[model samples]
Target: MKYHFFQSKYWVIVWSIALFFFACRDPKQNAKENVKEGELKEPQEENAHTTVIKTIPGGVDTPAGMVWIPGAMFDQGAVAQDQMAMGHEKPSFQVAVDGFFMDETEVTNAKFEKFVKETGYLTVAEREIDWEEMKKQLPEGTPKPHDSILQPGSLTFKKSKSSVPNLYDFSQWWQWTIGASWKHPAGPNSSIKGKENHPVVHIAYEDALAYCEWAGRRLPTEAEWELAARGNRKDKIFFWGDDQDLLGNQANTWEGEFPVMNTQQDGFERRAPVKSYPPNDFGLYDMAGNVWEWTGDWYNTNYYNEVSSKKQLLKNPKGAAKPFNERDRYAKEKVMKGGSFLCSESYCASYRVSARMATSLDSSLEHLGFRTVASVDMVKAEKN
Candidate 1:
């Protein structure tokens, strides 16, 4: 009887070891099976109502400057004679895009402050200038140890004298001020303490990059930027269709006499609150005004021509390998779309949807800000 019991125990031990080996060999399979079972029990929920007629919650405070643009295609370039005269916005093309979300407004001072406070990140303009790197670009006799060049600085347009003519010239308004950064917008004395609602200026591309990375999103590409701004219409002049001034309402931009006297007819002399105006047909706010937003594409004047020639629908098209002119030297400079609150007929007329401009990657201006975009994941129902 004792011998028989011993043999049975030995068999039991062997079985246990075999089971352990089998389990170890197929751990991944077991995990997959468990996942499948979970998935079967709880299927992913979809927003059954495909049409986004109503704005959803969590949509309101998606970082200031971001417009929630429902993804759809529109004419990508200029359709009118005025836009054609702008040089680069020619040969309009039908662009169909997948639905996606975009920021309703330009990024604001308050929103950027939250990003900086959380990450303790320093903007590129805040960092010290590398004299050696700058010297390499200049001629041999170029002044070294120059106060202006060596100083850590950023772009800040000095207020031109009221008497000065052509105050609208960008040069008059833009000044490279030492210690001028997002933190110290007007240099050392300025602080963002109470100006949180204002648009954060003096941000270089690197600064925007850092903020976007922290936020788990990215700057929109040029094609994506234009598409979102155009809404669901053909290449109309502005985001709100062909008429620049609709219903006798001035959406944005400076009024009155250029820099000397901003009439503030549009209710703002500088950057206004995001969503200060009504949204476009696609629920995008401030597509034509407020602040110029940056795009990922490198600026090339002939890029639109190339896209037009293709006659094929280009999905997420990025612009030229090299920049077109001296306007963009840093290669740091990328395309900026839409115009700003400072835009006026007498001065910069970049409010048009097809309008484009470029800014240095390391440069930032009071009128410069940005918005965010994401790829559309679903087909949206058409609006009535």
Candidate 2:
């Protein structure tokens, strides 16, 4: 198993299944692993309370389709009432983020198309796989898979015709489809012909960074994203409020049995068009669900432990220098905020504002997308 791991059918099945979970992990399962053997204590609320103080827009002309998020101080993690909170989201601590302009919605296909047309850029999903680089994320001395499995592709979610008993096996629903890039989200047969306004899917971390660089903007830090996604609310599990009843009306998420059925009560089974749902208090659309947005921070399960221990307001804190996912230590994961349409109460339930998930840095999937943010100074410089 150690010498020729990729050659054996048993090992290949294991490897593929491992990759599937790494690509779109079960947030609920990961939550259980984050805690110790004993009962988990929620983050102390000593610094969880804060008022939404308004700040002047500073006379900086706002960018088109971007809203100004006023600098404010607030708790950065799960609150006392979030029973669905994960262990990684523990240790709520006070954090302050400066004013910045953020996209009103996730980056749409039309905008991404413009970037691709102008730059002739190829997304990571479209690029050929490099086993040399990919193996770095696997255990040492792990043999590479056959050449056929190394084709350019991305993970695509397939709805199960019937209820599946093994929710832990992510491979039951996620498929590694060749030619499943942003342009062909569902697979080679699928096309983004009329879904231009929908958030672009299958965007890798580097692809997002490339788009941000071209637009003179950057991905939001986890703190900045949390602040913006919070929409200036105070101690609310959801952006709309603490009410769970409002989830269906406020955002797009799985309505029926997850992976088996979606009632589309929100009028979308998968990713919806930008602004398809009501905006948050800060005028940001789909911040809680629709598609999980990437943050600039690397995933670190214990990062909040460090932040909460500081006992002081952390200003624009970047994430850990490297990723550390307890379940997949070999993979380089990044923090993905907000949830996706696939999220359901029975499963991920990550639609809550504090809900966070992790995916490999090079991983891309249909339910994943990102938005960009620009500092006031960056916007000013772009105009000047």
Candidate 3:
């Protein structure tokens, strides 16, 4: 049920593009209440110093490219007054996660290449489209597209030369480029020649799972991802602190105009090399930007409300059992964390620690990537 209805079928392409637009909505529409520009509300003074992150140390034989994240209890959603916070990030709830070893950075192109070469694997973007399978997510009586248009490809970001009328239309910038896979990120013309150290983009959930299986790891749960992203900073807006001013200096996000112009103020226009920016206090890199990382959770808009209703601290709670986005019921979505280079203050400022987005499980986008985690015992087994 990969929902990559491409450009050939005009209506399907629009629907797919609409999903991207919905996920990356304008910041003005995301605010619960309007506040004066340049003004940010900080958390209550009393609660600011209460929570302390207790990180365990990785032993001498710790797993390669991983860091120990000591588990602790903390609120798992947006802070008190995150103006850019979206509805899906609401109803902050207390949750606990056990210490686990997580990747220091998103899986790199070199590593993914190693996996593909050894297994002769094909990413979702490399696999040919299945008309019958795709039809399941499409409306009834829709005719099968021409075989020529059904070629394998992934969604690629094509920046517009000038600003468009509105940001609501995702089709203005996102194009379904044929031959767009991890090997050829921009399309047939592009290659990962010099970007081996950069994170592997155009990775679908299943593709991530395949790599995790090979590496004896698993995608981090949404709760764990949030906790890790928060790092040693508790109840903060950005992973670094409550200050939005640090965003341009601390993370790889769009500075000037979003699609049309990236001031590259952060010194990166696209996906920066892994660890291009400083790591979080817990020694995790690219937790708030660079690219959106996949989490092992089915995205439900109301999942937070459901958890908040419990009113008790949840211990390592898994996410909603099923995907339930009212916007597009037919397309199944999983939780994606951290914003990409495309995120901006004018657009979706998803680099905040609590920012959450729903991305289709089958999506292999230029801005989508993933990292893996291993339990303490899993790490110990590696020594055997």
Q: Where is model 2 poorest over a 10-residue stretch in terms of lDDT?
A: 1-10
| Residue 209 in candidate 1, Cα distance off native in Å | 1.4
Count of clashing pairs, candidate 1: 15
Instruction: Sort the predicted structures by lDDT, highest score first.
Output: 2, 3, 1
Q: Of the pair 1 and 2, which is ahead by TM-score?
A: 2
Worst 10 residues of 1 by lDDT: 1-10
Model 3 alpha-carbon miss at residue 211, Å: 0.3
Global local distance difference test of model 1: 0.58
How many pairs collide in each candidate, listed in order?
15, 0, 0
Candidate 3 local lDDT, 143-194, one digit each (tens): 6666766778888898899987677666778887778899999899999999
- What are the lDDT figures for the candidates, one per model? 0.58, 0.77, 0.76
TM-score to native of every candidate shown: 0.74, 0.85, 0.85
lDDT of 2 by residue, 27-146 (tens): 111111132332122333334444342453556788999998988888889989998887888889887678788999999999999999999999878877666656644456766677
| Runs with alpha carbons beyond 4 Å of true place in candidate 2 | 1-14, 17-57, 135-144
The global Cα lDDT (0 to 1) of model 3 is 0.76
lDDT of 1 by residue, 219-295 (tens): 88776788777766645677677776671153678676555667777787776777778877767777777777877
